[model samples]
Structure formats: C-alpha cells, structure tokens
Target: MLTGNGGHLQHLCAQCTSCDEHAPSLPPESIVQMPEQNTPSGRSSQICSDRRQCIHGISRQTNWVVRSSSLPQRHHIYKISNHFDPIFKLEAPDQISTDGGTNLASEEMEAFFRRWLVKVHLSSAQYPESNGRAEAAVKSAKGLLQENTSKGGALESDKMAWRQHASHGDQRVASCVTGYLQLKEWTNTSGIDRGYGKNNVKILHVRREGVVHSIKEYEINTQLTLNNDKDYIFGDNSDIIATDSQKNTVYILAKKHGIVSPEDFALLLCTHFLSKYPYVEKAKIDVDAYPWRRIVSEGKAHNHAFLFSPEIQHTCTVSQRRGGSAAINGLTGMRVLKTTQSAFVNFVDDEFRSLPDMKDRIFSTIITASWQYNTVDGVDFGKIWANVYKLVIDKFAGNPDTGIFSPSVQNTIYLLQKAALDEIPEISKISVTMPNKHYYTVDLSKFPEVGSLENNEVFLPMDKPAGNITAVLGRATKSKL
Candidate 1:
C-alpha cells in the first residue's frame, strides 16, 4: 500500500517511539452496581467525585513544594514565605467639603474640571476674549451688506445671499470672542490687557504651533465574509488535494452551495493559495466547477441536503515537499461539548483564604485549536489537517484515562499537540496555544457564609478573568549532513 517514496515511512518508524497500550476498562459488574450519588440540599448536583470523595484530587491546607530541576544543588530550597504591604494609599484627603457632609457627585465635578483645563490653558493667549470682537465684526458686516442689497430676480437674489453669508463667516472668530468676554466682569478684564499690551504699543505673535489631534473613528465591520450567492453554509464541506498519480495536478470535492449560494465565495477567501494564486503542472490555472446537489428542497425534509450547521467537522491536508520541506497548518472551531474534565489545584494559600475542600471540583474551558502541518518526505498530504484535528479531539475526550485527568491546562495543551504530531505521517511537531476560560460556580446559599462547596453545588459565571494560557513550541533538529 506504500506509494511514492516508500522508504520515507521506514525512516519515520525508526524515529518514532513505540506506542504504549496500558488503558484499563471497568468490569460490567461494577457498572451495574454503581448507584447515582445524589444529595437533598447544597448547590448543584452536576459535580462528580471519585470513590474516595477527594475534591479536585487534592487535600486542603497542605503545602506542595515546587522546585526547578535546572537549579544548582548548592542553593537551599525555601518552602514557603509570606510578606504583606498595603496595596493602595487609603489616607483621607485634606480638602474641606464646602457643602455640609454630602458627598459631591464625581460626574459633575469631573466635567467642570475638564472644561476648565481646556479653556484657561488651551485657548489663544493673544485673543483670550475673542468673542466680543468676533460678534461686533459679524454684526457690522451683515448690516452693511443688507443696507445695499435690493429685491431682485431669483438668480440675483441668490448671489447677494451667498455674499452676505461668506461676509458673516469672515468675522465669525471676532464675534465668538466678543460673546465669551461679555460673561466676565469688565473690571477683572484689566489683568488680561496688562499681560499682552506693553507701553500702549501692541505686539502680535503668529502662533501656529498648536497641535490638533484627529481621531479617525471607524465602525467594526462584522460581516466580513462575502457570500453574495449564499453558497457556503453550516453543513457544507470541501477538500483540495494534489495527487501525483492522478491526471489532474489538483483535485477538489466541495459540497454544492444552496441554489444561488455564495458559500464557495467564503471558502475562496479562506483558501488563499487556491483562489489568490493557483497552479496545475507548475502553470497558473483557474478552478473550474459545475454545481451539483443530491436533492432540491421543495419543502421541509426533502432529501438530506447539507444542513445549515453541524456539530462535526472532518478536514484533511496532504502535500509533497520538493526538498524535504514539509509544513502543516490547521484551524478547528465549533466542536462544542460540555464536560467536567478540567480541575484546579496547586495554588498558594494564606490566613485570608477560606476555600472549602480541594478534592473534586469541575474545571472546564472552551477549546480552540490551530496547528501547522509538518510533512515527512513523500508522504500523503491529502489528509493531514483532518487527521490532526481528529487526533487532538480523540486525545482530549476519548483518551480520558491517559490524556487529561488530574491535568493542568498546560499539560492538556502539550498532550493535545503531541497527539496530532503522532498520527501526522510526516509532521515533525506542532505548536499550540490554549486559553483557560474558567467556569466557576458562586456559593450563594447563605448571606455571610458562602454555601459549603461539598454540597455539590455549582454555578457558572461568564464575566470573570480567563485562566492561564499555555503554549507548546516545536524545536527543529539540526544535523551536519
């Protein structure tokens, strides 16, 4: 069954470690005897516990020492240390309240402060009160223009109106400053005149050094995909592969979009290699396809055409490297599932901490996976991404016995990425990043005392901080060949 450069498979076998099979399955009798454990009162009953009833697989009030293996032996390991310092200055301000003991509304004071800062320091120094001058100039110019204009034809009248409007705008600055100065006391205005005028000789300085900031406001374009024909939908699938034995250099099998569907339009955006630039036999070529569907939708339930959305996704990538250069890339989303495979333990504790037991708590995070493809020389490139996604999911849920129990988010990421590398016939390794979005339940049974966590009560709060982020890196092997 080996095709095209079969010797490459032999080299892979030599480099790979032997797969181990130590997974155990429970006996049938034990399953029949297992009774559902339910409590009459607490929080939620969804939390599961082992036969030993340990919360999250850890004991409470116990300190676990962590040490780095790379450290020098001479350095003495310190187990636990605690120090305290005030996080913020809580001293009362010295400002006296003018309005009794009633607290001032911060919103009103903040607005007034912002206005003061801009008007006093930001306005032009030479024309501090330009409002009075701007208003008087505008009024004098408008009065002079109106005094000369007479009733005339539509065209003549329009011309006179335009001239008057422009003349008014020419004096707008003097009018604005004149209006602002009217609000202040005329006696207080002596200070403004003394600062700018000297020896009854006026001096003018052209100040054009002021900086003007322009914020380019933009609207978030959410509907980025252009499916004008409504072609791509939930259940649609496609595959593109390059085959050496086949007559065609590239072969693609895509599900037909809905009649007048633009699903393929979205696909084209995603597959830049195929759409932006494509090739067959080292020559540029455009993709040619004729639409075909299994059944036409007459009403509800016509033949099982591609559904709008499906819970399962299966994709694969296969490529042959010209110079022993293999690359893998993958993206996985919408594989939604609800499980309590997550657990949290190994955290520092002090006197302020009052968490119940650290035995069996549910830890969960939504998973998003993307990885590059690494190909061995002359290996099957048709099914790489598909295999990678499948292997990762299988390792996460299917191999619970060996994969993620008592596992940190970092451990889960390493295992998931490794599983993908294992089945990827030629891929050397994979890089993965996983964010741990914590789903915690609030204990709200009692007012002061939070409900005991042991009663198996659980609630999910969405607006909370995400857990730790873990990433796996792939290191290349360099040899002097």
Candidate 2:
C-alpha cells in the first residue's frame, strides 16, 4: 500500500508491468478517496496515470520495490526483493509532515539509514555511485512528483510542498571504508636468512623438502593511523599503495627464505613494514600455523600422503614499534585424559550438593596453554614446544613411578605447570585452563537382582554444567587455580 501526500491511499500491485495496460482495469473500490481539503483539482484520468507509472517504474528495477505505509506521524518503507524474500523496512519520521509539527531527531534519522543499509545488504558496496539501479529509481520518483505539481488543482499547495520536500537532500554525510588481503602458497628457497636454507637445499633430508606448506594469512589496516592526515582525508592514497606492497613482501620473503615457526614468520612481516614505510611507525602481525602429519600405514610413514591434525595449532603475535622493541607470545592446545586416577571431594554442604563423594573417577580436560618467551634469541621454539607439551601430558596422566591418584583437578594442573617451568627455563610465565568433564555412574535401582550397586561399572557421560579451573604459574610467584 502506497500513501500519497494528501492522505490518499492506493493498492499498488507488484505484478503490474505497464500503466496503460493495468491502471484503467483496477477496481474503483481499491482506491481510497482523499479528504475534501486535500483532494487534487486535476482530472481523474491524469491522477490514475501518474500513480500507476510510479508503481510500475519501481517494480521494473532489480526485481525489488519499497512501499510506504502510514502510521500516525511516522512512515515506514517496506522493501521486498522477490516473492520468496523477507520484507525489509525502515522508518522515516522526518520524511513525513503533520499538523502537529513533529519531526524525527537527527540521530534517529542517521540510525534508521544505517539499519536500512544493513537490512538490504547494501553496506558492502565499494562504490556507492556505481549502483545504477538505485540512481534510476530516485530519478523516476522525482519526475513523478514534479508531474503531479504541474496539474493545477485543490491539492496544488500540498503537491508543491511534497515536491520541495522530496527535492531536498539528506543533511548527513557517510563514508564506507574497507581493508582486504590475499593468500598464496610458495615453495623453493634460494638464499639464507638465519642459517637454515644452506647450499644443500637442492636435495634435503625429505624429497618434498623446504616447507611442508608455505602458506600465510595476512591483513593490513592503516585507516586509524591515516585518518587524521590531510592528504588521506582529502582522498590522497599514497598510504594505500604502501599497504598493498606488504602483501607482495610476504610471498617474496617466504620464497627467498624457508618458512620457520609462526613467531619467526610474524616477526619478519612486522619488521618489513617498520623498516620500509617511514610513515608506518608501528605494525602488528598475527599468524597461525596448521600442522600436517605424515600418514602411517603398514608400519611405515608415507612419503607424500599427509593428514591434517587438530591436536595442536601454533599461534604467534608480534608487535613491532618504531624504537626497535618487540613482544612475542607462543600458544597451543593440548587434550589429555586419565580414566582411573582423578577425584573431587571435600566441599561445604549446601542445598545444591546433590553430587556424591568419590575417590576415583574419570578426569578429562582440553587444556589451552600460552607461554611468553623472555627473549627469542638462541631459542629453538619447535623443540621447546614439543618438550613442554610432552611434559604437561606426562604430568597429567602420571608415570609408573608417580601413579595417578589426583585429589583434585587443581592439584593436577599445578603440577603440570611446575613441570613445564622446571624443564623449560626460556619461558617466563605459563597459564593453563582445564574444564572438568563429568562421567556419572548409571543408576540401576529399578532392576530386581543386579548384585551390589556400589560395584557397578556402567556410566553416563555429561557435557554441560562442568567445573572450570584456571591458573597462572611462574618461577618466582604462584597464583590461584
């Protein structure tokens, strides 16, 4: 339903293709007559022609049309793309004029337009003027209003007022900015950077040598740093050229020098931006390395066949400053479980204490551990990570000498932390979080003869309402778990 300036209502059919073919055939009862003071003095034929043309022109563009519905002083534009699509609507109170002299606030109008763009999925347009369909629709709507004003009638004043209202442009200004990146795989190393890829790079230990998969994900955003520069604010884009060059540098460096750990890869990326671009004082790079393990079949590892492993994911963050200072963090995930040596007991009695005491129960936890390196110099990150991870698992599952008799999850995690810090001295601090997965004993009270229930072995595993235990451990200080 489309409402005109004089409170006249018309049912605009979306299937109508042409005004001459559909306007005269519409039933008389479908159109609502305007009030005496607001009715136009033009002939009935001209009014019907203008109304049908406005509706027909909108439906022909992009297979979508938006119609306004009257609601007191507020007006809403509901847009539909197709018969199967949902209706997208936006309120325009300032677009309507009433006798009470009420209008929408400036903030309200801006928010309404923002929400409209998101609803119609038009906010991602790289160039707004490139949308020719929307431009054509605006032009058609404006021409329809101007034609109505030319017809002298009782609605001449109202028509002229609406023409002026539609002619005015929005007072607010908006800008849409975007940042993009690309990814590619590179192989074959030539030169050496830190004494890894040497002259024997032609035939190394593995035939599929160099990097298992030398692929990196990168993104560069300089909007915040350049927002205040006069050259950038006024549309000078020399800074954007610098950002695009960073993408090329990632491939060039990876092809020249072999791929190492994520920390090293991220550090190389950050160093390039700070050294090459004088305007870019600081740069942050984040990298994650996915592990691919060789498949073992018939007691031997395959040469080219590999399987993706989610057991451990390597992540690193490097922040480079203009003063030549950097910070790096190494993180990974480890899943460990013990079936017969974990317990939870000794808590204050309360109404929610429906759980029974147990001395032995299955304990399972997925641990996420992060360690900050004191210094990257002379440090073998791959070796240290493998050793530290093995130590953590060994402490959780226990060995033949120690046995598995954990009093609580907290105690087990503390021991795991202490073991990692004791063997790996390069790490300054370590943090671990363990979520307690419950495995409850199945109840068989309804059964007639099932021997003693205390000795029952059946159990039911639960995934929710689990306990969460976290701790941060260091060589010199201790924290709560």
Candidate 3:
C-alpha cells in the first residue's frame, strides 16, 4: 500500500494482502511472503502477488507517491491503466499560479515532449528489453509511416501534398537522366569551332552540309546536384523534369551549335546546366561519340554516306561545379604499325622465359590515346587533338631524327609522349596504351621443293599470349601523370 498526505491510500501495491473498502481492491491469495532472512533491516520489500504478472522474473513493484500538499491546485494527474500504456503522464506548466505569481509557460512543455520522445525512441532501439511497449510502438509507427509515404499507396496523395507545401515539408533528392542522340544534323562550316577536321580526310566529309548524316551518335549522361532542404523529393513529382529537359537540350544544342569535337560539345553542356539551373550546384556531363567513317568511292570520300565504325570511339567526361574549374578528359583510338622498327630484349629470364629475344621485329599496336587539357576556356581542342593524333602516328612510325630502328615498346611510347607534349603546350599529360598484336613468321623447313623462307614474307597472326605495353608522360614538374 502506498500512502499520501494525511494517511490517504494513494495506490494499492500488488503484494498487499487486503485493502480497505475505500481503497483499490486486491486479491489476498496472490500475495507471496519473502523469507525472513532476506528482508532488509529498515526497509520493506514486496514481491509481485501474481506469479504470471512478473516482468523478467523480477517481483518488486516500485511505487511513486506525490503528496497532495506538494502539488498546486491547478496541477493535473493521469493514471496509466496497464503496462502497455505510457509510464509517465506529462503536464504543461501553467503561466500563472493560483496566487497570481509567475510560473513556467507552455513552451517548456513542448520542449519537454520533444526531448522525451527522442529519449524514448533512442532507448527503445538501444535497450528493447527495458521498454518492450516503446519498442513495439516504434516499429509500428515506422511501418505506418512507410505505408503512408510509399508510391501509389492510399496515403501517396497526402504525402505528395505535404512535400509540395511550402510551410509543411521539404524536398531534396538527387536524380540522373541518361539519353542518346540517334541522329542530329551538324554543319561544320558554321564557324562556331572550325578546327574539328584539320589535315584529316575524315573532316572532308563533315565540311559540307548534310554530307555526313550520322557522323557520330552522342550518348549524354548528366547528373545535377539538386538543392533540397530535407532531401526528400516525391517519387511522382517533377524532380526528373530537369533530367528529361537535358535530353532534349542535347539535340537542340547539337542542331544549333553544330557538333565539333566531343570535348567542345561537353563543355557547352556543362556551361548550359550551370547557367540555366539556379538550384543545380554542380553538373557532371559524360559524352561518348561513336565514330562514323565515310565509305570511299573509287578512292574518294563519298558525300551523304557513312558507315558506323564501332572499333573506335571518342569520349569526353566533364565535371563542372558552380564557381569552380571544369575537369575535362578526352580519349580517342589510333592504330599504328611499323614492320621493322620495334624490338623486345633484355627482359628478365626465368622458368617462364620461352620467348626468344629479338633485336628487330614487326610492331603493330592499336593505340588508345587519352590526354587532358590544362583549361577548357579559350582552348582550340579540335586543333590540339588533331596535332596530338598526328604527332602520335608520326612518332610511332619513326621520323627522320629517330629513324625506324630497333627499340623496346616502352622506349617508343615514351618518345611518342615527349614529341606530342613538345608540340602541344595546352596538353598537360598524355597516356598511351598499346597492345602487342603479334604476327609470327612461318617456317618452310619441312618442304624441300618450296625453298627456305629466309626473308620471312609469309606469317601467321597470333592473337593470344601477346605482350601489353602502357605508359603515361607529362612535364618534369607534373607528377600526377
């Protein structure tokens, strides 16, 4: 039994054997008396009257008693009926006391509730055994919230309405839209960026209008960093409108600005998104331009005709942040061959050294050259790329200064980079990957009448077990390459 002021019965303890008629009723037979040796000297401890009602096998029933004189006249009291209910009742402090003196306000009550809810939720997750009801309630609440917020659900309309409301909710979510331009007309003579085709026969077909119907199929992938307060965007909202608009913008820009090199076009795209969208903080634009070469007619480049060449492609990936420098990377395919200049020798000889050292051997490689520009502004990417391509081919084929002589692929790639960097000052670094396409000379020793194959004119092209060589070159101070 718990007693209040003036000896009033406030609560009937579960272990109480009997209660007065005025007090709450209790079952007398449920009371269990503890062993006398276990009792404390000054304090009284009671066990749960009903064995089935015990929690975690602990029988003690803790009681809290508030004296009537301690509470104000206006103070409210709430009783919890069962263990499933909230353990404590909350009361908002009154602004004025009964004596007309200043008291705590209702704002404190709101703060108290917020802190209490956070503590309850955190404790329920961290220590579920301490408050099973709180844990169960938290799980139920989460499931209910998800059910109300899921797309196409019954509460979807309300959730969306709340997200759109200015004072009610917030929207912040990231989205990416990828699109491909199947066919877009690009007139090269528009004078926007005229150095797209310099000293290359491929440019001859793109110089005239409608001559190259589908010169390059551009695949554009743009990601916009959106600004939302709570980072919650409705699933069915117009958050993807910007992405869809970017797809259309690609075609429109291609038709209007004319497709130059992939780097130039990618720069235009980065500029468009950063300038157009006020909410977009950064834009990442990646473009892959598929190559298309014109079918030659009697050794002449055909007009209004083209063939898709999937063997090679030009790629440009540009990342533009608001008020930041743009990072641009460009890559293209180039194949070069020199029948008697390349060699492989002086390598480590181990148990796996089955390959014989050769001072002079045929070199053929499909080169994929990638380079980075120092800056995108005011740079003639088309001209620089053309010069770089020519320099790579010339160096691979050997020049007058470095004639076609015996050397390793490593030496050849280094010289290739050195020559390109010497001519193109705008290029900060260049990376070249050359895979060795081996062509083995055939032997005719068994055939006596066929004569000896001394010159080794006849050969068999070996696809597997070929050597791979790669290297990157930059200025003396540039170590990142």
Candidate 4:
C-alpha cells in the first residue's frame, strides 16, 4: 500500500514475475507448478490511470501467454515478456511502495514499466517514509490472503499469486538464503557458532601483514622455547638459537631450499629450525605473503616485474613441537562488489532497529578466509590456492555480466567456505569473515522528476559502522557421520 502526498491510504498488489537471473533461486517446493485445474491468472488489459489517489485494492490481471497445465516447474531464470502481470494494471499510482518483494528490481521488469511511463521507486524498509503504513499494508494484505486460502478455500489462486510475488525477493519470499535460515533453526540460541577439535598439532594464533621476500614476500614470527626452567633458568644461551643466526639462516637457506609458495617457504623455515635445534622444545611460526606483477610493456607482460597490484594476498601458519606433528594453514582475501543481486532483510524488529529490509542493494565485502589443512605432506600449495581461489570468487561473482544472488554476507561467506571444502579435500575446516560494505541510495524524494530520471543510479557510500559477519564450517567427523 502506498500513502499519497495527501496522507491517504493507497492500496498496492503484487505481480509475481519469473525468476530474476540475479535473484537467488527459490526452493524446489517454491518452484510454482501451473495447477491442472483452471483458474484465471487474475489480470485485465486496462491500463493504470494517472491519479495519485488510486483505489482500495486493484484487480491484478494475469497476462499469461501460455495456459498449459503440462508446463513444468521453472528451473532456470527466464525473462517472460508479460509473466505474472501485476495487479496494478487497473490503477497505476505515481509510485508503488513494497515492504519487500520483486518489483522495480530486474532490468526487464523495469523495462516493462518504462514502456508504460510508470515511475518505479523502491521504498526502503530501513527508513519508512510512511512511518508504519508500509508495514501495515503488507501485514493486512497477507492476513487477508491467508484467510482466503485457509483450508484450501476457493481463493487458493490468491495464495499462489501472493507466493509467486514473494518468491521474486529474498529469504521471506524464497531463495538460497532460506537454507541458512533452516540451518539457524537447527542450532543453539547462541546462533551458528561452531568450533572443531583435532588432537595432533597446536594452532599458532598469529597474523602479521606486509611481509617482503621476493616477487613473493613474507614476514615470519616465531615463538622460541626461551625459558624452560633448566635451560634459560641457568642463564644458558646454548639451547637458544641466536636471533642474528636465525636472520642469516633465512638468507642462506633461501638459495638451497628455494621459494615456491608462501606455505612451502613457511614449512621450510619451521622445519629447519626444529631439525637444527633439538634442545629448543616448541617452534610456532607464521608468514604473510603478497604478490607483485610486471608492468605491461606494449601488449605483453614484461619479463622482469616493475609494479605491484593490490590483489588477494595469501596467509600461512606452521606450528611444530619436538615430538608432535606439524600443522599448516592457508588463507586468501577477496575484495569484491556487485552492482545488484544482493540484499539484507528480515533481521530483528526492535526499537533499536533502524535499518529496514533492503530488497536490492549495493553489496561489497572484503572476504577474509582461513582454512586448516588435513595433512602437511607434499601438497601443491600454489595449485590448491589457485583452485580454492577460483571456486570462492566464481561462486560470489558469477559471470561478469550477471552475478549470483547473495542475500546476506553470512550466507554468501558460508557458500564460499562450503564450496572450497567440498571441492578441495586438502582442507578440513574453513572460516570466513565478511564485513558488509553498505551503499545507501541517495534520497531523491526531494526532486521527484530527477529521482525518476536517475532512478537508483545515484548512491552514497558509508565507511564507518560497517556490519561485521563471520562464520566457520568444518567437515563432519567419522563418529558424527
């Protein structure tokens, strides 16, 4: 329902369109099956009249070109010319405000309205200009639709139509985000906090950035067994390897061991120290690696690199004690954004909540992922990095032209970790932290004409107070399985 400039209630109805390619796919159950029984797709050819104050409830005419019961449930996103024609065919208001759902979202859907010269303004659930009227309209409309469809009543079409409309949006309507919700339901009240235990090697919780080595560079931090009662207690420097020697060892060993990948180099350093100094009990080491590329000379990349690009960096950590086995981990950073096909909605609804359910939004995030390796054997670190990197990135940013639907950073990051683990068995557990980079649409209500012209093209970026989301996923243990 839309509140007019005069502060009067104006009713709005849903037009359930086909799946948006960018929209997260709905559930298998939610895939609408055109029923065998004949029920008119409620629609009329009458065009909406130009009146700010429209009718109570508009009769949404279904412009179904094909009326076949044999039509299989939709699997792929297709642009139906006039599919799920909206109920607003009768009275087109100056603007239609939706609490949430597919309207004024997809390019094709927008084009459908452009042909009729109707302005599409997406109302924010974060900031409700109509106070509570926008929410009231959704609640009241849903209540009526549910009442009509109770016990499989005659108005089942209304229920079906409503669902189809809702499906065009995120979790509430239908999408992959629903799966995360289901997972959440199965968990404790603390909400999706997970931890894994592997009994061999200890984890060295150390991370330092900007390490320089070669074209590939790293900074190493080590925890040496300095004081062990008898060793350093007697003022003995025998067991303790000199810091100066460690420095020389790094430079001298670089020629013999060779630099391949960050993980390999890190493993080399930790193993060297452990093997050389037996009296030194525990040795925990961490390395951060960054890449540099050659500048483009004409059309080809120069043989000798000159410049550096700010791309995803790799992380490595190795911990080895005297008798215990070694533990090594790898990590990658993904800085990405999609102009469309991401949303945040259906969160807490308390007095403290000011942000609304944004149906479509400018979503960008700096994804930081770290995963523990199953074994520190002769693994191809570079190949594994490339494989996992492609999988994580491709899943988030689909084809360059079109991006996969990402409802929340939590859900998206979960998918990223899941994809990496499922595809690569070398990693046993993975954790990803994605901070929501918010871009608010510039308020164009002041200039309605300019707003209609520019549409959602203009936006304001936010740097401070970013929403932080993190999740950890691990493979099931044998006993649990």
Off by over 4 Å in 2: 1-207, 210-248, 323-333, 400-402, 449-452, 475-481
The residue-by-residue lDDT of candidate 2 on 1-481, one tens digit each, is 1112221112222322332222222122212232333222211110001111121112221211123222222322222122112222212111211112112223443354355332111211343332332333334444444455544533454443333222112210000000000000001111211110011111111233544422333222221122113232233344433444555566676666646666776667667666775645456665656566778889987666778777877666666666653444444666666778777788667998887788778888778777777676777777887877776767787676666678888898788788878888888878888887777877776564964556447778785988889998877755676
- Give residue 481's error in model 2 in angstroms: 31
Q: Write the per-residue lDDT of candidate 1 for residues 1-481, one digit (tens) a residue.
A: 0011224323422443320110012111111111322322111101011112111100001100000012122212221000000100111111111111111113443243243221111112243232222222233333434544666522444343223222232231211211111111211322331100011111111112244211111111001122111112111211112222111111121112221112222232234333432321111111111222234366543333333333323222222221222233444333333355555565667887665444445545555554544533444433565576566676556665654464566776777776666655465656655555444566555645745634355657453656546575554679889
Q: Given candidate 1, what's the lDDT at residue 242?
A: 24
By TM-score, is 1 or 2 better? 2
Question: To one decimal, what is the Cα RMSD in angstroms of model 2 from the true structure?
Answer: 20.0
Ranking by lDDT: 4, 3, 2, 1
For 1-481, candidate 4 gives per-residue lDDT tens digits of 1111111111111222322221212211111232232222212112221112111221112111101111113312242323323433432333333333343346765676666544554445354432132333233344445655757456775344333223332222421211112111212223322211121221212222344223555666655553122222224333457665666666666667666776776677777877876545556666766556667779877554457566777777777666564555555556787888888899999999988899888888887877888887877878887887887778788778777998888788878888888888888888888887777887777777555544588888885789889888989889864
Residue by residue across 216-322, what tens digits does model 3's lDDT show? 56677766654322233224343333455676777677777877777777778778877886655567777777677788899988776778876556776777777
List the candidate 1 regions with Cα displacement exceeding 4 Å: 1-304, 310-327, 334-341, 348-358, 376-382, 399-404, 447-457
Best by lDDT: 4
After TM-score superposition, what is the CA distance of residue 140 in candidate 3 from its true location, in Å? 23
> In model 2, which residue pairs have backbone atoms overlapping below 3 Å?
41-153, 41-154
Indicate whether candidate 1 or candidate 3 has the larger lDDT. Answer: 3
Better of 1 and 4 by lDDT: 4
With candidate 2 superimposed using the best TM-score fit, by how many Å does residue 66's alpha carbon deviate from the native? 46
Off by over 4 Å in 3: 1-217, 225-243, 293-312, 327-331, 400-403, 446-455, 476-481
> CA lDDT, every prediction?
0.31, 0.46, 0.49, 0.52
TM-score of each: 0.33, 0.50, 0.53, 0.52
